[model samples]
Target: MLTVSNLYVQYGERILLDRISFMVGDRERIGLVGRNGAGKSTLLKIIAGAQSPDEGIITRPGSSTLGFLHQEMNLPKGKTVLEETLTAFEETNKLEERLEVVHREVATRTDFESDGYMNLLTEMSDLEHRFHLLGGGNKQVEAEKVLKGLGFKDADFQRLTDEFSGGWQMRIELAKMLLQKPDFLLLDEPTNHLDIESIIWLEGFLETCESSVIVISHDKMFLDNVTKRTVEIELGKVYDYKASYSGYIEMREERREKMAAAYSNQQKVVVQMERTIKRFMAKATKTSMAQSMQKRLNKIDRIELDDEDTAVMNIRFPVPPRAGQVVIDVRNLTKKYGGLTVLSGVDFKMDRGDRVAFVGQNGQGKTTLARILVHQLPPTAGEMKPGHNVHIGYYAQNQAATLQPNLTLLETMELHSPPEMRTRLRSILGAFLFSGEDHDKKVSVLSGGERARLALACLLLKPINLLVLDEPTNHLDMLSK
Candidate 1:
């Protein structure tokens, strides 16, 4: 079992985690959920011993081993995929070598009854046991099995690590960790770059893995399929729920209802006590009762409801004059870079009010088509036409770079908004959960979520009949998405 007690973590003056505690049983699978900056990653780092908390005790059995996978890590280049995967057996390989040395010495000895001989034989037996336990007998076969399970082909196993992209390199690192077979695994956003098929394969692998797992993921379906429990971090505290993602949502709603009811009851009691004290202050006998009631009210513990932070992006584009039925029509669209073809004569159409989601592999040209539709990039050889009265509002995935970094939140909105809509800027900002000091913050200082919200706010300043959004939910939280 692994346990955390009274964990506290702070970043300068800001408290990220406060007195949080939880436990994981031997084979438990836990899913950690929270907003982007709610310390989900920080907690995983602390558990992995990569970062120390301000005050806490993490206890695990001395015999346990841990494996951690972070989003960013320096992986050794110029190594083949097979060579990298085989490195997990380095210690076992050394043990096998030592066992070979012991066997040779034993064979050369003429006297089998000698004390030293007996000792050497016993040590050799122990080494053989451990070697088999570590899969030294079939290490290469096991490594290939793990590689294939992670979507790597046998033909690609000998390819150099540097030949692969960053995302594929991350998968190599993950493959190595999975092969290690540690007692516990700490995974942070393991499904970030995975395709739908790869993600399903990984989820199945994790489900049957022997190690205990604690993963932080934004994919609700993944969590629901893999984890048996949900651990929620909110407002610098942890709430443990012994159920899957859907069940946890039900329990959270029930908790909120109970809290609301308790608060209402307490308010009624306080009001009645105040009225009694005001009406009977002059009567000596009743004055004591009123004083007792006042003291009881003062000592009562108040029920504080969990404050839900609204999404900082409330995007509602102003409606432009109605457009024709067909907003965008594309035909025989083909895109290529030198010898690599991204899209090949793909044809699609978008109506005025269609909310379409393009799903495919990372490099399959979804974003490329979005850019082409918005006129940001011209297609290699195709025609795209907008219907009558169609006005487009384009949102790029990297809006943080597109928005003016020097402008404050208030200024960015005002610059794009018309004079008549300027008066409603504060209300619009409030809808996006930006108010008072938040509006004064510069775009450069905002987080990814904040930048995305500001960019969406800019879109709402103009009238648009069609919205071409490219991964608009990339930086958004679960609720925001």
Candidate 2:
């Protein structure tokens, strides 16, 4: 079991976590959830030993191990996908090599009564046992199995890791983490880079895996499928429920309702006490009685309802200028890099005001098509024509990463916005849940979800009728998604 006691975390004046305490039972699957900037990722980093808490202690068995997969990871460039994943079994590989050495020593020694010969034989036996227990014989098969489960193909296994995009590299990292099979798994936004089928595969994989998992994901269905418990962080406090995401949502609502009711009742009592105190104060003979009552009222602990943000983003695209009926037309579109063809003779048309979605597994050219639509890439052959007066607002998968790290949130938005938008910038940010001191926060300090929201907020400053979003909801919370 993993236990967190009196955990405290603070950034500047904001108390991200306030003396929170929780426990993860053996083999438990927990869904760590909260809105953007609620410190869900921070908590995961703390548990993974990547970050330190301001105050608190985490206790677990000395032999227990942890594997963490976060958004940002630097993968070795020269290694192939399979080879990189097999690095998880480095200890096993070393043990196997040592076992071979000891086996050879035992075979060559002819002195049956010598202590050295007998010791060599015993060492080989122990090494063999350790290697078998670590699944040394099946390391390659295990690596392939995990890679395939995460949407990798058998053909792609031999491809260089650096040849793939960031999303594919992230999958490689996840495969390594899964292969390690640590006692505790801390995954932050694990579904962000996964396709629908891969997400399903991962759900089944986690359900059967022996490792206890604490996953932070915005995908509600994924959480519901994989997690057995939900831990929510809100207003620097935590609410734990022995239920999945769907059940936790219902239980949280019930808790909020109870808090509201108690707050209402307390308000009534507070009002009554104030009224009685005022009446007694009006009489000179009862001044002492009023003072006593006022002291009692001051000592009363006021009930507070849980504060939840229910604000909805109101987004309206700008009217498209007069244009031809055909918003976009493509014929025999083909794209190739070297000998590999990502898109082959793709043909499609979109009329004005029509919405279309390109869905496929990673590396299947979904993003390539989006980029092509926005004129970001040139097709090797065929044609893509846009209607007259067509204006496009594109949000790339790496839009948040493209933001200037040194600029404050408001400044970043101001740079992208038109002069007319400047007047309503705060309101626009408010719609996207950035307000008050949030505007002053530097982009570098924002979490993935917050940066995504800020990036999206910038796009809305001057929208076009044709809005092309690639993996737009990857980093957003459920409400924002």
Candidate 3:
């Protein structure tokens, strides 16, 4: 069992966690969720011993190993897929090596009844038992199995790690972590770069893993499929719900309603008491009653509801004149760099107001196709034509670079909007929850969700009938999704 008590974490003046506590029993799967900057990742790091909290105690059983998969860990290059994964069994491999050395020494001995021969035999037997216990002989097979389950083909196993993309490198890291098979596993956004098929395979592997696993992710379907419990971190505290994602939502709603009702009843009592105190005080003959009311008021505890805000993109496309049915058309579109083909022989069409979702695994030409459709990347062997009155408003997935870092929220809108639309800049900013000082804050200081909302806000300044958003909801919360 792993347990945390009085976990208080703070960054400078901001308190990220306040007296949080939780436990994970053996073989339990828990999902950690919250809004952006709600300390989900921080909590994972603290548990993994990568960060130290100001005040807390994390207790785990003795001899229990922990495997943590962080997002920003370095991977050694110049190693094949099999070699990288086999590194996880370093101790087991060393044990097997020692066993071989003992066997060789025993075989080279002349006297079979010698004390040294007996000692070697006994030591070899113990080493053999330990090797078998550690699954040393089958280590290579286990490593291959995990790598394949994570979507690496058998032919690709011999390839060098440097040949794969960043996302594939992340998968290698994941495979190494899985091979460790620690008593507890801490995974942060494990499915970020996975395709649908790979996600399904990983979910199955995690479901059968005989260890306590805690994962932080934005994928609701993944959480519901893999986790048996949901641990939500909100407002510097933790709430434990003994159910899946869907069940947790229902229970949270019920709990909110109950709290709202209780607060309403308390407000009514406070109002009635104040009214009675006013009526009696006006008489000038009920001084004791007024004093009693004052005491009660002083003793009453004000109820404050949870101030939970959901991250959402308030996107309103600027309406343009109605266009023809066909907005975009591509014929035999093909894109290639040298001999490598990113996309080839792809035929697609987008009509006006078509909200098609491009679903595929990472690095499967989804973004490449989006770029082609927007005319940002020229196709080598095909043509794209826009129909009459067709206009395109594209939102790039990497909005951080596309947006001006030096510009404030209001300034960004002013730069993109027409002069006549400038009058409504305050209202527009308010709609995106950027009122007050937030409007004056620079885009560089904004969080990922904030940046996404600002980018969508910038899109509203133009008059375009067609909108193409690539991974618009990548860093958004549940409400945003």
Best by TM-score: 2
Residue 297 deviation, candidate 1, in Å? Answer: 4.6
Candidate models: Cα lDDT each: 0.82, 0.88, 0.82
Q: On residues 1-481, what C-alpha lDDT tens digit does candidate 2 reach at each position?
A: 9998999998777889999999998899999999888999888888888889999988889978899998778898899999899998987878888987877777787898989887887888887876775568899998898899899999999999999888889999999888777889999999888888899999998998888999999888999999989999988999999999999999998988999899999999999999999999999999999999999999999887767766656675555566668999999999998898999999999998798988877888989889999999999998999887788989998899899999998899899999977888888888788777788989988889989988888997785778899989999888877
Candidate 1 stretches with Cα past 4 Å from truth are 73-76, 80-144, 154-165, 273-281, 286-302, 310-312, 316-342, 348-355, 361-470
Superposition-based RMSD of candidate 1 using all C-alpha atoms, in angstroms: 5.3
Q: Please report, as a residue range, the 10-residue window in candidate 2 with the lowest summed lDDT.
A: 311-320
Residue 311, model 2: lDDT of 61
Q: Give the TM-score of candidate 2.
A: 0.88
Candidate 3 Cα misplacement greater than 4 A, ranges: 11-14, 94-135, 269-304, 318-327, 336-343, 360-364, 375-380, 385-466
Order the candidates by lDDT, highest first: 2, 3, 1
TM-score between candidate 1 and the true structure? 0.74
At residue 344, give the lDDT of candidate 3: 85
